[model samples]
Target: MQDKTTLYSLRKTIGILGLALPILLLVTHQDLLSSMSHYYYTAGGVFFILILSAFGLILLNYRGYPKQEGESFSDRLITTVAGICILVTVLIPTKSENPLGTLFFTDYPYLFGHESNGFLGAIHLLSAASFFFLLGYMSFYKFVLNHDASASKNRLFRRSGIIVWASVGALIIIFAIEKILKINMDEVFPAYTFWLEWVAVYAFAVAWLVKGKIHKDFEKMIKTFQTEKSLKKH
Candidate 1:
C-alpha cells in the first residue's frame, strides 16, 4: 500500500512537471522559440535542462509495478530507456538556427554547433523522437493494461495517447514538408513546432495525472482540510 502511494505521488509529480514545463518556459523567458528543444538557447535553458534531468533520474529510479508472468519488458525497463533518451536529448542540444538568448555552449569543444557537430544534432533529434514515442506507448498500452476498456479512466488514457501520437505524426509531416519543399511552416504558423510539442507534452501529462488518481488525491486533501477546520471550530 505504501509503495503504491509512493508510485502515485511520483506519477503526479511527473505529470505536474510536464504540464508546467511549457508555461514555465514562456513565463520565465517571455519568448516562444521555434520548438521546445530550442528553449535550450533561452534563459529557460536551465529549466529545460533541470526538469528533463529530473525526469531522467526519476524514471531511472522508478521501479514501477511488479512484473507479471509472461511479461517480456517490465515498466521499469521501458521507463529507464525513456529516461536515458530524454537525457540524451538534453545533453545533445538541437540545431539552434535562431538563438533567443546568450548562446550558451554553442561553442563547446567537440559537442556543440550544428555546423561543427551535425551528428550530435542528429542524435538529439533521434533521442527526442524515441523518448516521445515511448511516452505515447506507455500512456496508450501500459497504462490501460489490466483495466476494462469501458472504464472512463481507460478511455481518457486512450484519448490522451492518441493525441500524443497524432502530435508526433503532425511534427513528422511538417518536418518532411519543410525539408522537401524548403519552406518553413513557422513562417506562417508562427511557432507551430512549439505548439505541437506543447500538445504532446500536455497529453502525456493528462494521462499520467489520471493514472495517479490525482482527482481522488485532491478530494482527500480537501476533506482533510475541512475536517481540520471543523475540529478547530468545535
Candidate 2:
C-alpha cells in the first residue's frame, strides 16, 4: 500500500508540473516565443530547463506498476528511453537566431538564428519527436496493459494517446509547410508551436492525473471533512 501511494504521488507531481509549466513560462515572461523551446532564449529559460530536467530524472527512475503475466516490455525500460530523449532535447537547445531575454552561458558558443548549426538542431528536433512518440505509446498501450477494454481509465488513456499523436502530426505538417513554402507562419499566428505543444502536454497531464487516482483522493478528503463537520454539529 505504501509503495502504491508513493507511485501515485509521483504521478500526481508529474501531472501538476506538466499542467503548470506553460502557464508559469507565460507568467514569468509575458512575451511569448515561436515555440516552447524558444523559451530557452527567454527569462523563463531556467524554469524550462528545471522542469524538464525533473521530468527526465523522474521518468528514468520510475518503476511503473509491476508487469502483468506475459507482458513483453517493462514500463521502466520504456520510461528510461523517454527520460534520455527528453534530456537530449534539453541539452541541445532549439535553433534560434534571437535572444528573448538575458541569455545564460555567456561564453558558450551560441546556436542562434538562420546561421545556427544544423546538426545540433536536427538532434534536438529528433530527440523531442522521440520523446513525444514514447509518451503517446505509453498512454495508448502501456497504461492499458492490465485493463479491460471497456474500462473508463483505459478509454481516457486512448483519447490522450490520440491527442498526443494528433498534436505531433500537426506540428510536423506545420514545419513541412513552412520549409517548403519558405514562409514564416509565426507572423500569421504567433507562437503556434507553443499552443500545439501545450495541447499535447495537457493531454499527457490529464491522463496521468487520472491514473494517479487524484479524483479518489479528492473525494476522500471531502468525505473526511464532512464527517468531522457532522461530528462537531452533534
Candidate 3:
C-alpha cells in the first residue's frame, strides 16, 4: 500500500510539473513575467522558477524506490543529478532583456538578462538541455523497467518510450532544418524553441503519467491504435 501510494504521488508530481512548464505562460498574465525579445518569453522566468521549485520538491520527497538495502543507489543518484540540473537550469534563468516578474527574481537580481555573459548563458542552455535529456532517458529506460505483466503496462511503456525518443528526434530535425535554412531561431520566430520545449515537456508528462497509471483502459486503447496502424500499413 505504501509503495502504491508513493508511486501515485511521484506520478502526480512528474505529471503536473512536466505539464506546468508549458501551460504556465498561457495561464499567466503578461505583466507578471519577463518580456524578452528572443528565445525567452515574457513569462518564462517565473515559469522556470516554478518548475524548478516543483522539481526540487520532487527530488526531496521522492519515495518511488524502496529504501531497504539501498539497492537503488544509482537510481537515487540519477534522480539527484537530474534534480540538480533542474535547479541549475532554473537558477541560471534564460537570456532575457526585460524580466517583469517580481517573485522569481526578488532574491536573484543577476538572473535577469544574464545571457550577455556568455559563460552563464552556456550553463543555462546546457542545463536546460540536460534536464530534459535526462528526463527523456529516464522515461525510456528507467520507468519501463520491472513493469508488471499487464498488457496495458507493456503498451504504456511502448508509447512512452516512443514519445520520448520521437520528441528528441523531432527537436534534432527541427534544429537541423532551421540551420540549413539559415533561420535566426530567436528573431525569425520568437521563442520558437519554446514550442519545441513544450513538445518535449508534454511528451515527458504523458509518458510519466502513463507510468503512474493515469490512463484508464489503456490496454484497449493500445489495441485500437495497433489495429489502426496495421490497417494503414497494409
lDDT for each of the candidates?
0.82, 0.81, 0.62
Clashing pairs in 1: none
Which candidate's lDDT is highest? 1
Best by TM-score: 1
Compared with the true structure, the alpha-carbon lDDT of candidate 2 equals 0.81
User: lDDT tens string, model 2, 103-186?
Assistant: 444345544422266898888888888888888888888878754434888999999989999999998999899999998877
CA error at residue 27 for candidate 2, angstroms:
0.3
RMSD (CA, Å), candidate 1 to true, equals 2.8
Instruction: In model 1, state the lDDT of residue 213.
Output: 82
Candidate 2 has which clashing residue pairs, if any? 96-113, 97-113
What's the count of clashing pairs in each model shown?
0, 2, 1
Error of 1 at 94 (Å): 0.6
Question: Model 3, range 98-215, lDDT digits (tens) per residue?
Answer: 3434333333444354535668766876776666777776666566565463666656656665666676566567668876997655555555555666777787787777777765
What TM-score against the true fold does each predicted structure earn? 0.89, 0.88, 0.67
Count of clashing pairs, candidate 1 = 0
Candidate 1 per-residue lDDT, tens place, 1-234, comes to 129788888788889999999998888788767888877776787788898988888788877876667777788888899999999999888887754333444555424435335788779888988888888888887888854434888888888888998998998999899989999888778888889989999999998888888998889999999999999999
